[model samples]
Target: MSGLAEILHDNGFKVQGSDASENANVQRLKKKGIEIFYGHGKAYVDHAFRVVVSSAIPDDNPELVAAKELGLRIMHRSEILAEILKQHHGIAIAGTHGKTTTTSLAFTVLDYAQKGAGVINGGVLYSLGTNIKASSKPGGFMVAEADESDGSFTNIHPKIAVVTNMDAEHMEHYKNLDNLRQAYENFVMNTPADTGVVVCGIDHHEVAALAGRVSDRKVVTYGLLPEAHISADNIMQKGAAMGFDVLIEGKRYAGFRINMPGRHNVLNALAAIAVGIECGVDLETIKKGLMSFKGVGRRFIRIGDAYGAMVIDDYAHHPVEIESTIKGTKGGFANNKVVAVIQPHRFTRLNDLMDEFAACAMDADEVIVTPVYSAGEKPIPNVNREELAKRMRANRIQNVHVVKDPEEFNSLVQTLVTNGDIILCMGAGNINTWGQFIVQQSKLKS
Candidate 1:
């Protein structure tokens, strides 16, 4: 939503909004001359032409109530995004994970190809230093990260649609895995049959199934599987970077290296490659763009050296994401002991995937489970961090600890980590601050 505000403000719209509290995004919008209220109130909506609310916002919000009472236009964030999609050749990246990274990579590739494209990414692209970039060039492309949490992604009909992978995510909205699969199927089918294409990750069973049903449009499958139209081979890891060879339709296309770690990222690059090729970008340009991408914020971002240990922050909330991230971290720092500090995101998710989360953290040498972040939902009985730690221990995870307080977790991490160790902070919530706090404490001690 903040990214959308920035894009609207750049396009000469009088954009002003309110947040519950001030944060980096609020400050960023303020710097862009967009009025940002620190808290929500009815007065904030008095003079607004239209009120835009995200999925997180409730109907009872004061500003939302004011908008309705005043007969002002009210729009969901997805509605605005859908409208924006119609103005350009849109490339919408969607999935249970990796949407932000893949969308940013595609944007970088298009920009490297000298195509002045506009982008609305879910997270800050570290290279661009922002989540959005608005292009003024005529007939240019617009790349966006499609959010599937609320089922609003079905509103978008893009020229090119990329599904990095599908998993049982946002179950609160879909209620079951089958429903989530159907949503993705609809998203792919919504693409224009004549001029649109779907880039899918065939490694995932659900996504591969969706691809099998895509007979009306151009569909490209990418992964390590030989059946994939665009497949990666000869994957080699060097330090924190990964190198892989890409094959397009059984012919080797190019060998590329990305600064990101993990086989999942290699799949992400393959998706970008498929999109770039479909959009007429040369293989060399695509390689350069993938190599040039620094990374998206909070997606395995190295915060700093802390007490002789390297601290990395990542937004890995789901069990699948957590497993993949831990695997990547282990591959990157093969010799270093991995200490995972995790804060489960929401109560509903924790209750639903407790056993999976416990099993996912098995790769880490030491696991520190923090209290649930509870984005907004009330806590579920017997679904706290201590129970999660107990489950991990029962699963034969050697060392597991529970720290209910963030400050205590920081102190515990300081004592547990040593020189040459990798401290991984994983969550979708404010656990990134734990990484920052550790770095600050390390600097203070130094």
Candidate 2:
């Protein structure tokens, strides 16, 4: 939403908004001369032409209520973004996971081409240093990370679409995995059948199945598998760095290296390479963009170094995402024991994937489980943090411990940490605060 405010202000629209508290983005926007209230109130929207909100906002928000009473226009964030996207040759990066990274890589490569493109991602992209990078070129390429949580990504179809991978996620809105897959199909089908191309990750069974159904438009397949149209082979990982040889149609395209840690990110880069290829970017320029990408905020991003230990953070809440993150950390820091600090995000998700969550952290040498960060959801019976640790113990996961309170967490960080340890903070909520706080304490101790 802050990104929207900045984009609107950049385009000569007077914009102001309200948030519950101040954050880095809010401070940055304030410096940009946009009026942002620290808290929600009816007065925030008193003189507004329209009140825009995301799916996270509730109907009872004071600003929204005031807008409705005053007969002012109200719009969803997706609605506003869709309008902005129409002006450019939009290329949407859509999937259940890895959309932000893929979108960032695609935008970086296209922007490196010097052809002028724009991007709006879910997180702060390291390449752009912001969520939205608007281009003045109307009808030029625009790369955006499509939000599939509320099924709003179907509102706009891009000239080229990249499917990183589709899984059974956001099931609250989707109701079932089949519905989610169908929604993805609808999103791809909306793309221009004459010129639009669908770049898909065939490693995922669901996404591969979706590709098979996409008959009207061109589909480009990318993955580790040899059968993929664009595939990565001869992969190597060395402590948050990866080198891989790219192959297109059973032939070598080029060998590329990236700063991202996981083997999973290879799939993401493949998607970006496909987009860059569609935009006429040379392989060298594409390599430059991929290799120079630092990382998305809180997605395996390093915070600080304490003695010989390295503290990194990530926004990996789902079981599949968490497993990948833990395994990737261990793979990167081979000699170091990876300590997995996990805080489950939502109650609905925990209730749904209890078994998966219980076993996902098995790769880590030590696992610290924190209380569920219920993002406004009510707590479920017997599905708290302790249960997760219990289940892990039952699954024969050694060194599993439940640290529910802040004091316990602080002590755990201070005493349990050792040299040659990768302290991984993984979650989608205030666990970032823990990561940042741990780093701050380490800095103070030195």
Candidate 3:
């Protein structure tokens, strides 16, 4: 929503918003000259032409209620994004994971290739230091990270659609995996038939199936599979960096390197490369753009050093994301012990995928489970950190501990970390604070 405010303000719209509290994004919008209130109320909506609300905003929000009483037009964030797509060549990145990084990479590639692309991402782009970048050139492309959690991604009609991968996410909304797959199928099918191109990661069955159903549009498959139109070969990890050769149509297009760690990121880069090539970007420029990408904030971002150990923070809440992040960290730091500090994001997710989460943490040498971050949801019965730790131990995970308090978790992390170790704090909630706290504590100790 902050990105939307920035975009609107940049386009000469008077925007004012109110959040429950001030955060980094609110401060950013304030710097951009957008009026942002500290709390929600009806007064903030009195002078507004329209009201925009995110998925998290409740129906009873004071501003929302007042807007309806005033008969003001209310719009979902996706509606505004869809309208933005109509003005520019749109490339919407949709998937259960890796969408932000992939969208950021694609935006960077287009921007560097002089395509004049704008971006609206979920996380801050490390290179740009902001989530939204207005297109500098007229009639250029807009790269957007499409959220599939609410099935509203179908509202977008993009020139090119990239699905990094699909998984059983937001089951609370979809009810089952098949329902979620149908949503993705609809998102892909909603693309422009004559000009749309679907770039998908064939490694994921759901995404591969969605690609197969796109008969009227161009479909580009990418991954480690031999049948992929764009595939990576000879992947090598050097510490926190990875190098790989991009193969297009079974031939080497370019050898590229990225500062991010993981094969999933290589797939993400492949998606960006495919999009760039589809949009007439040169192979050399695409390689350069990807190589220059520092990575999105909180996606395995190295926060600081804790007793010579690297403290990394990531937004990995789903089991698949957690497993991929841990494996990627292990691959990058092969010799270093990977200590995972995890805080489950929601009670419903923890209750639904307890076993998968347990298995996801098995790769880490030591696992520290924290209390679940409710994210506004009511707590579930018998779903807590101790039970999760017990499940991990049942899965043959040797060292598992629970730290219910955030302050105590920081102290535990200080004692558990050592030189050459990598403390990977993973979750969607405030677990990144653990990484930051450990770094600050390390600085104090030093």
Candidate 4:
């Protein structure tokens, strides 16, 4: 939303917004001179301005009610983003995962090639040093993480669309995998016929089927599989990083290095490679661009190491993401024990995918489940940490713990952790604070 706001602001549109509370994202926007309020209320609404909000906003929100009463124009965040898309030769990165990384990487390539693209990523790009960047070039294009959480990607008719992977997620909003697949299928179908569709070939049959349906849509595929148009070959993991030789259209594209540890990131780099290739960039520039990426905030970001333990934070909430992150950790940190501090994000997701969450989280040497983040949703009857802990334990996962508050969570880690421990904090909520608390406490003790 802030990225779109930046785009509008650059295009001479007055923009202001209200978050439920202030955070890093909001602070970044304020730093850019965008007016932001801490809470939503009728008082924030103005007769002279239009209103834009995410789907998470309730229909009864006071601002919405007031806007309706005033007969002012109101647009959802996706709609406004779509309006911005129409102005650029947009390249949208869409998927259940890896969209942020791929989109950021694509932005980096454009930057290195001097394309001067505007980027709308879901996470903070460490390279750009911000979550968004408004370019000074008119025809430079806009690169965005086209999200499927609310089926909003349907509104973005990009010339180039990339799907990193497809899986069952956002179950609260999507009735089932079929519904989710249909939304993605529609995303591919909705793109303009003149551009490319890069789909992940490592995905399930549903994703492969969706890729097939868009075969006529200038499709170029990628994955670790031999059939992929771009494939990662001769992969090696060496201490919190991965290096691999990339094959594009059956030709060697030299070796690429990703400091962010994960096969997911390898695939993410591949996705960016596909995008760059389709844009007529040479292999050397593409490799240099990919290598130059430092990574994004909270996407396996290393906060610090303390008392012989290394702490990493990631914005992984879905089962596939969690599992892949664990796999990445095992290969990257060869000598450390993986301790997972996971905060489930929303009630609807936890209630729907409890079993899958349990299976994925068991990969850690120790698992700590925090209470659901709520996100303003009332709790479902039996979907809480207590139940989640019970289910994970039933799988014979012995080192499991549950904490509802930050204090106890910190205490548990401070007490149980030792040297050479790899503490990975994962979630989409305030659980990110645990990394800061742990580092602060470690400093005091030192």
Candidate 5:
């Protein structure tokens, strides 16, 4: 939400916000003339401006309670963002995965294609050099990553909606995967009739159902397979990058290259292509847009090289995400041993999908599990990393260990990582801290 604050501040809206931690984002916001509070404070709430809170924050937040007690207007972050988009045509990228990259891609394409556009993303986009950007065009576009973690996508009504793919996730919030799918369907259906909805054909059935429901919106499908409206064909791998020809309507239109790791990224590129093509951008413009993307900070981003080892930090917290990320790494470095330092994301996710997590990490040559990042959730019995490591060992997976801190993780990597070894620090938590520590130490020793 730092991006939102920055954007508002730039637009002459007095912006003040609070965070639980004073991380890089907080620091950046402070530099951008935003008054940032490090902790919750009732004093932060005042009668001068509106208060915005994300879905992750509870209704019981002291600031929110104070705002309510003062009878001040309050808005969910998503709701306020939707209001901000009113002055510009909006494209909301929604999905369980790939939203960050795709949304970043869309904004980059618009900017590079010389069409003025604004952007908001969940992750720090290297292209914009910030999480948000302001544009100055009468036909300006607002491109945003529509998050569905707390069903926030429902609050956004974009002129264009891109559903990368819907996977069964955020089970704690949604009753089931079906409920999650239905929520996406409602999001699509709620769009204006003249708008377009681009659905990734990988999740053809789930997203196609949305197309069936939204008769007013134009629906287009894209994927790696030929069955979609836009398909990626003749895929070739070179290191951590993939080069493929994007086919539109069974005809190959143009060649595309994505330096980002993973087959899932091929799908993300296709989504960007679809959006660009619909917006009347040239094929070369789209290709350049994709090529210029250095990738968002944590989506398979290489932190730095540590000794002879290559360390990558990724925000893959789900089982499927873990498998995809590992597979992508293997595709890039075929002969290198994969050492994974995995910090299970949440207690509830660990308890719910323990077996799947084990299966995903089993692909690594060596796996080290760290204490779960609770994210404020209470721990469940027998659902810790030790139990996960034991299960992986019992499953005949070799070289699995449980670690408590970054020091232990660095020590494990020092022992296991050989020349040309690929070390992946995987999680949605502070696992990147360990990766960064290892890389920094390696740099210092060298």
Candidate 6:
């Protein structure tokens, strides 16, 4: 929503918003001179010409209610984003995970090649230091993250669409795994038929199956599997850099390097590579873009050093994302034990996917479970940290412990951690605040 605000403000629209509370993302917009209110009420949006909000906003929300009463031009976030996309040769990246990184990477490739690509990402882009960047030429080209949580991503019909992988996510809105998969299928199927192509990761069985469902649009596949049209080999981690050789239908292009970790990230890079190729960028320039790429914020980002251990943070709320993040952080070269600090985001999600969540953190030598970070959702019965820890214990995960609050979490990090341990904090909630708190506690604030 902030990305939309940024882009709209850049496009000469006066954008002001009201949030229930302030956070890093809101702070970024404030730095850009965008006005944001701390609390919400009808008076906030009373004078506004149009009020924009995501699907998560309740109907009873004060501003939304007032907007309807006033009969102002109210719009959904996806609608505004879709309207922005229609203004350019847009590329919409859709998936349960990796949307932010892939969107950032695709923009990097185009920006490096001087294609003047704009970006609307879920996370802060390290290269631009912001989530939204206007295209160098108006309506020239752009890339955006297509959200699927409320089945609203179908509102966008871009020239190019990329699906990193499809997983069971946002089940509260989706209700079931099949419905979620259908949404992803609709995302690609909704793209412009005459000129659209969906870049997909074929390694995921469901996403691969989704490709078959889209007959009118061209589907480009990339992954570790040989069957994929675009695949990579000789993947190695060099300190923090990952090097791999790209293969296009048995044709090899050697020495593709990205300054990020994990095979999952490699797949992300491949998706961006496919985007670059479709944009008419040469392989060498695409390689240069990948080499110069920094990374997205909060995806394995280092927040602090506590008790001689490096603390990494990521927005990995789902089981699949957590597994990928841990496996990526391991990176096959570190001797240090990986300790995953898992915070269940919502009670409903924890209640829904207890089995998958329990077994996802095993790659870590130790696991610290935190209290559920309810994003204003009501709690579910029997869906607490101790129960989750019990499930993890059933999986025989080593050293699983549950921490009730930030104080205990900080105590454990500073006192018990080994000299060379890697503490990876993963969640979609206030876990980032915990990372920041640890940094402040350790005087590691940079």
In order, the Cα lDDT scores of the candidates are: 0.89, 0.87, 0.88, 0.82, 0.82, 0.88
Q: List the residue pairs that clash in candidate 1.
A: none
Give per-residue lDDT, candidate 1, residue 338: 96
Give me the candidate number with maximum lDDT: 1
TM-score of each: 0.98, 0.97, 0.98, 0.95, 0.96, 0.96
- The pairs that clash in candidate 3 are none
lDDT for each residue of candidate 3 in 382-442, tens digit (9 for 90 to 100): 8999899998999999789899776787778777777889888889999888778878877
Runs in model 2 lying further than 4 Å from the true structure = none
Q: Please, what are the lDDT tens digits per residue for candidate 5 over residues 100-154? A: 8888888878777988888888888876678888877864888888889999778
The model with the greater lDDT, 1 or 4, is 1
Ranked by lDDT from best down, the candidates are 1, 3, 6, 2, 5, 4
Poorly placed runs, candidate 4 (over 4 Å): 194-198
lDDT of 1 by residue, 122-141 (tens): 99988788899987576569
Give every collision pair in model 6.
none
> Which is better, 3 or 4, measured by lDDT?
3
Candidate 3 wrongly placed segments (more than 4 Å): none
Off by over 4 Å in 6: 444-446
Better of 1 and 2 by lDDT: 1
lDDT tens digits, residue span 1-446, model 2: 87888888999999998888989899979998998898889988878888888999988989889999999988999888888888888899898778888888888888878868988888898766788888858788889988888999898778888888887778989998778988899888878987889999999988899899998788999999889999998899998888999998887966698888898888889999999988899888999878877778888888886545788889899989999988888888877888899999999999889999999998999999999999999999999898999999999999987887665776687767788788898999989888777777777777
lDDT of 4 by residue, 316-408 (tens): 988788888988998888677888888888888888788988788766888888889988888999999999889999988869999878778
